[model samples]
Target: MSSGKYAFTKALKELRFHHCQTSPQSQAARSFLVRAYPTMKKHNPQTPILIREAQGIEPKVWARYGFGKERMESLAGLDEKAIESKVTEMATSEPQS
Candidate 1:
């Protein structure tokens, strides 16, 4: 198998592992699931077209799960600190449980 295919396979395995570990009630897990489930349902493509287009390789399972150059770049640019601060502010302002 090629390096790209190997990497894609590795990533898919890791995602599945992580997803299995996520708790339904945890805010972080719920947030991730909420975002991911819809995308998975809506797209339902066998392979990531984005990766295939960008890498000139056959689309792999990992790509179907949304790993690609566009996603990588967007993730790299994300300001985690800012996002955390916003989440913190919103949580604090909301009525307590």
Candidate 2:
């Protein structure tokens, strides 16, 4: 019984470590995406370097002003609901000339 508990604890620790590593990778990816894709770097020109790392459809601080596959793929892992919400948010938040 104690061995089983130890194994579970060990597994959880390993999972946590993996999660931590993936987080930085995703953050770096997001940062690189913002810079490599022009549209993403357009919005809020003052802080073009701000990279959004949220999982849901929050307006990416980087690519809030343009449209394309670059935008879609930046949000590729989000679910339908989150994507819809992001679309709505983007639609509402666009700056009017």
Candidate 3:
């Protein structure tokens, strides 16, 4: 029999499951994310990136795991550059694997 102590704990990072609509603005954001993805992968390669056409909606971030408490973050306020900056900032914060 094994000891009572826990085996291990793994960090379930909030995946970037982006829901983008079919529009000029959403398309732009999608392009920007596609470009920035490789850089993010260089750090957290396991980070899942999925894109789906969300009708009548602007580009937004939603949860893939955990309780649904965090508000849906709209990409409306951010341009392509802002998106790149945010991605870069997040990549830097993660510990290099």
Model 1 misplacement above 4 A: 1-14, 17-25, 47-97
What tens digits encode model 3's per-residue C-alpha lDDT throughout 13-93?
Answer: 444536455676586578776775555445555556556677666776542333442223566667877765554444334
lDDT of each prediction vs. the true structure?
0.27, 0.31, 0.51
Residue 1's lDDT in candidate 2: 13
> Could you estimate the TM-score for every candidate?
0.23, 0.24, 0.56
Q: By lDDT, highest first, what's the ranking?
A: 3, 2, 1
On residues 31-97, what C-alpha lDDT tens digit does candidate 2 reach at each position?
4343333442233233323333344332232223333212222334544445434533443343323
After superposition, which runs of candidate 3 have C-alpha atoms over 4 Å from their true positions? Answer: 1-12, 62-71, 89-97
**TM-score-best of 1 and 3:** 3
Clashes of 1: 0
Top candidate by TM-score: 3
lDDT of 3: 0.51
Regions more than 4 Å wrong, model 2: 1-73
